[model samples]
Target: MEKAWWKESVIYQIYPRSFNDSNGDGIGDLKGITQKLDYLKDLGIDVIWLSPVYKSPNDDNGYDISDYQDIMDEFGTMQDWEELLHEVHQRGMKLIMDLVVNHSSDEHAWFVESKTSKDNPYRDYYIWRPGKEGGEPNNWESVFSGSAWQYDEATDEYYLHLFSKKQPDLNWENEKLRDEVYKMMTWWLDKGIDGFRMDVINFISKVPGLPDAPNPEGKKYASGGQFFINGPRMHEFLQEMNQQVLSKYDIITVGEMPGASVDDAKLYTGHDRDELNMVFTFEHMDLDSGPNGKWDLKELNLLDLKENISKWQNGLNGVGWNSLYLNNHDQPRMVSRFGNDKEYRAESAKMLATFLHMLQGTPYVYQGEEIGMTNVRFDSIDEYKDIEILNMYNEKVIQGNEDPAKVMQSIYVKGRDNARTPFQWDDSENAGFTTGEPWIKVNPNYKEINAKQAVNDPNSIYHYYKRIIALRKEHDIMVYGDYELISPEHESIFAYTRTYGSEKLIVITNFSSEHVPFTLPENLKLTSSELLISNYNVDKNEDVSSFTLKPYEARVYIGK
Candidate 1:
């Protein structure tokens, strides 16, 4: 397999809004991020994937871009961002900004002009169509809930917004609009900034006719994903982007492509395809989502997780690359979702980290993930700050007249706010994230789970993550090795092997809390085993072939 710096990088993701607050403004900003570079450097992360900080209306927590070339007032000025970049580079770390180009803020100058007239030059910059049958052009549901089409009184037409009404979908088919996007990308690369983590990148291209989503249930709206996701002109647009902007620079590019399959990913990230370096696949993430969708929570079957992860690992093995992650700005804390966040938070967190980092791809560690931050459960929906949660509550409880308790239960489990709470720095007020009231509530367990507490303890999840990250740099097998699943049927154990040259690494992770017995596969063997890393202390003389794995116990072994 080919090797590159990005292939071996351990990326740390920072949701700028919740990381830290400077100036007592109750919001995290660029200066706050600058103050924490050393903390990240100590954790051994090579790249920082910062969530969107561009000038925005904060409709979707900065995902709605109003000015792509400028910084958000809430985040700080351009100078603050530049200084933050300089500090990160000085610490031998790289920074990658979130690129949310599937849509632009309704407040963007282009959109503002586009909505003013039907024949305006900027009208084609966004997707607009006349309403059909005195209704929406299509029966597509806004991701936030409601009709995807929004009526514009000024233009006497309707516009498509896959997300909130404030975020209008861009028309990538327009050559002039595509040029504008490429020009903006070049300006960023010229600023000496690192690459981008493109948001909803695969949703850029849409089917020729904006057709209605299949509504077998006869619902008012449904997902039109098939028409837009991995659309016909996706590869063409991406290759054009590469040739025009990305190819001119030396930087890493990763796409946040939800619902992308291995075959689609191979086309996007294939070495011969000149499109992107890697993509964040959602196959593994949807394991717990019931038929209804993300909010329709269900038990996380271990076998399902094993199958999903192994498929991506083997399918993208040498053809393409993967972006490994569990928790991010959008999902709930991973430990709380996948592991016992109460009694075994520390152990399970380390185990999950071990499993992901040992894989043959780059691993992304979300902010607060190193310290094993668990999800938060607020008392009322009023306490939540995420638009997704607010909109859902209004739709289900108010409009749809569903049971409030059931809706809140789903929110407790899957709300984006579970991951957006202020960073737990210490036990002080607001978890030391801000001197004033935080934009969102801090998790009450911050007293025990704060970074200060974790960093001081050598056995904390923080230290475990630091060790795992350093180990990745110390071993080439973790990055470029061929992967093989050890036992596909084990319900509680996820074991895999990576082979490179004469070196082989066996990674064993107990996905459950039971005291399970684990044995090597009949065909696999370890002649001379050396313990690489483990969540539990190892007895040097313990048998290598079989052992009783503790709750969420994880270990990595190196041998022939």
Candidate 2:
């Protein structure tokens, strides 16, 4: 495999709104991020994938882009962002901004002009269609809730918005619009920014003709992803994007592609495709989502996780690269979702980190994840801040499809807000995220899980992550090795091997909080092997095989 700086470096994701509030304005901003550069550097962050801080009405945080070239007033000014870039560069870290070009805020100048009249020049810049049979253009569901098409009184037409109504989808089919996007991208790259973590980038392309989605559930809104996800023009647009903007810069690009299959992922991330460095696929993350979707929560199936991850590893082995992550700004805390967050949070977190970092991919560390941040369970729906969760709650509970209490429980377990709470820096009143009232409540357990405590403790999850990251830099095999799942049928253990030349790395992870016995395959011998890292330190003279793993224990062995 070819070598690249991004493939070897660890990318850390920071949701700017919750990272820190240097101004005590109850919102994290560019200055706040700059102030914490040393903290991230100390944690061994090589690339920072910052969530959007662009101008928006805060409709869906900053995902709704109001001004592509301007910074949100709430997140400080362009000058502050420039300082942040400088600080990150000085610390030898690259900064990648969130690219949310799939949609623009309704308040954006383009959207404003588009909605003015049917013949407005900017109208074609966005997806607009006449209402069909006195209703929406199509029976498409907004990811948040309700219809995907929002009526525009002035233009007597409806605009497509896969997410919130305030976020109108851009017309990627328009050459002029595509050129504008590319131009904006180059502007950012020319401004000394690293690259982008493209937000729902795959949704940019839609199948021609307004189509109605299959309403299997017979619900009010129907998910139309089948028509748009990886549409016919996706590859053409991406390749054009690469040629026009990305290929000109030596930067890393990762696309967040929901509803993307392994085949689609291969094309999106293939080195020869000139599309993206990697893509984030959610197949593994959806292992716990029941038949009814995300809200219908179920126990995580370890076997399914093993199959999903192993499929990506083997399927994309030579065709594409992988982006390994367990938690991000949009998902629940890893420990809370997959591990015993209360009794074995630290152990399980370290175990998860070791399991993923040992793979042949670039690993991402979400802010507060290094310290084993668990999910938050607010008492009431009003305490939540995520629009998706609130919208789902209203659609399901308030509208009489499900019980409110049960839905609240689901929200506590699967809601995106679980990851959006203010970062717990210390055990201060607001978890040291801000002196003023936090935009969202901090987890009450911050006193025990803050970074200050983790840095002081050598056995903390933070140190374990730092060690794993350093090991990745030291071992090329960790980044470019061939992956083979060991004991693929193991119900509670996820074990894999990465081989590069004569060097071999065996990673074993206990997915559950139970004693699971594992015996090494007879063909594989560990007598000459050395234990590289483990959640529970392994003695140098320990036996090579046939041992019972402790709850949430993880071990990595290196050998010839």
Candidate 3:
């Protein structure tokens, strides 16, 4: 494969609404992000992937875009966004905006016009189907929990919405719609933006006829993923997109695909495929979920995680690429979900970072992740503001009469609000995130885990992230080396080697609190060993082979 800037870059994901609040209205805005550019620069982030700052109705946060070319009023004005872009460029960093073409806010002009009447010129812009057998057009379920089809009184038809009803699915089958989408993308690219992180890009080309989903359990509306996920024309649409807008510039592209298979990913991201540069696969992220999906939490089997990730690492070795991440705005804090957020928070956080950064792909650092931030456990469901959590609570507790305590527990462990908490800039009233009441509550542990304390302490997780990011730039093997798993059946220890030319990079991570002993494979020897990085301190003269690793410890050794 070829070397690309994005392939070696460390990308930081910023959830704009929760990042920093410049105005007293208590919502993080574009200017606040501009003010924090130096902070991100200090952390050694090469690229900033800003979550949707586009015009929205706050439905699904900013993922439900209202306008393709305008900025959200809560986020900031277009001038503010332009200044932020200029500042990012001036600092020698790049900015990649989120591309949310999968669906649009119901309030968007296009959607509003399309929903007026059947004869409207824009009516075909959205997927509208007639009722079948006095019920929904299809038995598809919305991702946000309801029927995927919303009835329109005016047209007497149903429109498809894979997510929230407010986010109606666009009819990609319409040539005019595709042209409009391509034009909007071209408009953004011409404005000097770097690239895009396409949201649910695979769901655009759904299966033909919008077939009914199989429901063995016979629930009202089961998942129709089989009909839409990595659908028939997914590749053709992406290739057309690449030819129309992406190939014209020297930029990066990553698709946010949930159910994409490894083989499907090979075609999407292959070097000669002329599609996306890489894809954000959800295979590794879903390991902790039970058969019931994200809400039904289960213990994360270490071996399961190892096998899932190793498959991707080796599966796309020479054919395609991967987007490495543990947490995002839609996921709970990784430290709380994967590592110990209590006793060895800092150590385990660093260990997680070292574990992910050592992989052979571009690593994403969600906002507040560099400082060891944790999940929030509010007193009650009323305290939460996320739509997904609130809906689940309503259906399970208020509506279905389920135990409120159990639902709250699930929210604490798997809720998206845990990651949406305001950034802990300091120990101040709102974690120094806003002067006014925040749109959402700040994490209560801010006094201990805020960035101010982390920056002041030399051994904090923030500085550790900076060091690991710098190390990636200093070593080519970290980015492009061949990955090989060691002791694949190991339960608690994640050990792997990345070999580039003659140098080998050995990484060992302990995911548990118990001390674990590690030994090099018989075929490998550290005759010219160098300790590159570790979460635990070690004497330079201490022998590394067959040594016991402390709780939440991670270390990297390079050998010739």
Candidate 4:
């Protein structure tokens, strides 16, 4: 086994637009992030994974990068970004930028030239194909709905965009494009930043000769995952990237791979593999996704959640590392999605935190998660700012003639804007997010769930997170321990144990609102166990054979 700085660190993801506002321009910028460095420092964050701040047309909320070298005008100038990097380093915290090279904005110079003409030298930089039989090149569907191929009148061909039409997929088969990407990566690492969180990195390499995906529902378009995810040359390309740029730096790299598997993850993040340090797998996130994928909603299966988490932990143990997270800029808040967001909001939030942070991987805390920020269900679809939500509503309800209320219900629960809403800082008019109008509506619960109140209250979720982070730093077993799932068949209890040499830790979480009786495994004894952390106050001397845990309760016991 090996020890790395990244394995011992905790990452905090900051969605810049929703984090804070400094200029009161209704948008958060680099200066605003600098203003809150001290607050994050107090929260015990070691690495700050800032979402994409590159120059863009705002097509996919900055994921569509038009310029890799420049900062977005809305997020402040190059100097502001420089000061932010310096300040984060000054506080002993590392900063990692989002690497969105899987696709570049259609407005980028490469794409502009690529679409100019068929013979253009840069034409090979993007994936373009002639139409087939008076239709698209393939039956593939865009992640945002409709055909994945967009007709370009200028080039007399269609370009592939797995996401929005404004984002064009890059041709990774081109050596010149790969060289340019590597050079751009080196330029950033040389600029004194940490590393990158690669956006859809696994989708970069595609199978030769684009093919039609299987249509299960007989829809007009099909899921292109079979032809794109972890494609033929993914490892080859990543290794070249590592050899050309990443290998030269002491930085961490995490790939945002949507459809990758445990076997694929091991190859990508294995210690011997010259690729990324870790990867984000979405098996756990997809537990609630129904037949038609994410848009088709279904109730979350608690036992499935436990199985998925435990599988990852066991599969990656000693092979590669894992990146633990329940919420991000793209997903609804964890407390709102997995826990009771009404009565047991705080309790369930703490319980979920205990379950994730005590695992055998580095944990990520999305901004405002420390205060149990729940989902926001705006009254109408027009109130939504996320392109994905709006597109789904338009396609499903407006065009497909589906039930309007039913579609809205899915949007309310799964919309990305639920997490993209401005961070609630106080009880001000705009939740202290901005004096001017916020880019998105603030969650109305901010008055009672802002950071100000959490910071002041010792028993708040914020402080509880702080204490859990401190314990991780203090315990070597947290990072190096071997994990085992206990009672994997338990429907309401998510329980696991971590053991490193003689040190052991038992983490039990009640995921339901009803009281449940918990019986420890016969192999485990608690005579010498010390309560390390718990969401609810518990009697340590109570009988271990039959203990009833309150609703949404979590307890971590440390044993010698």
> Residue 145's C-alpha lDDT in candidate 2?
78
lDDT of candidate 4 over 482-510, digit per residue (tens): 99999989999998999999989999899
Q: How many clashes (backbone atoms < 3 Å, residues ≥3 apart in a chain or on different chains) does model 1 have? A: 0
**Where does candidate 3 stray beyond 4 Å?**
none
* Residue range with the least summed lDDT across 10 consecutive positions in model 4: 537-546
List, residue by residue over 1-560, the lDDT tens digit for candidate 3: 68899899999999999999998789999999999999999999999999999999988898898898999999889999999999999999999989998789999999999999998989989999999999999899888887899999988999999999999999898889999999999999898888999999999998889999998999899899999888888999999999999999999899999999899999999999999999999988899998988999899999999999899999999889988999999899999999999999999999999999999999999999999999999997888988899888888988899988888889999999999999999998999999999999998899988999999999999999999999999999999999999988888999999999999999999999999988888877867989999998988887767788999999999998
RMSD of 4: 1.0
| Candidate-wise lDDT, in order | 0.92, 0.91, 0.93, 0.93
lDDT of each residue in 129-175, candidate 2, tens digit only: 99989999999998897899888887788899999999999999999
Candidate 1 local lDDT, 42-83, one digit each (tens): 999899988999999899999999999999998999999999
Error of 4 at 78 (Å): 0.5
Per-model root-mean-square deviation over C-alphas: 0.8, 1.0, 0.8, 1.0
Per-residue error at 442 for model 4, in Å?
0.5
Which stretches in model 1 have alpha-carbon errors above 4 Å? none
Clash count, one per candidate: 0, 0, 0, 0
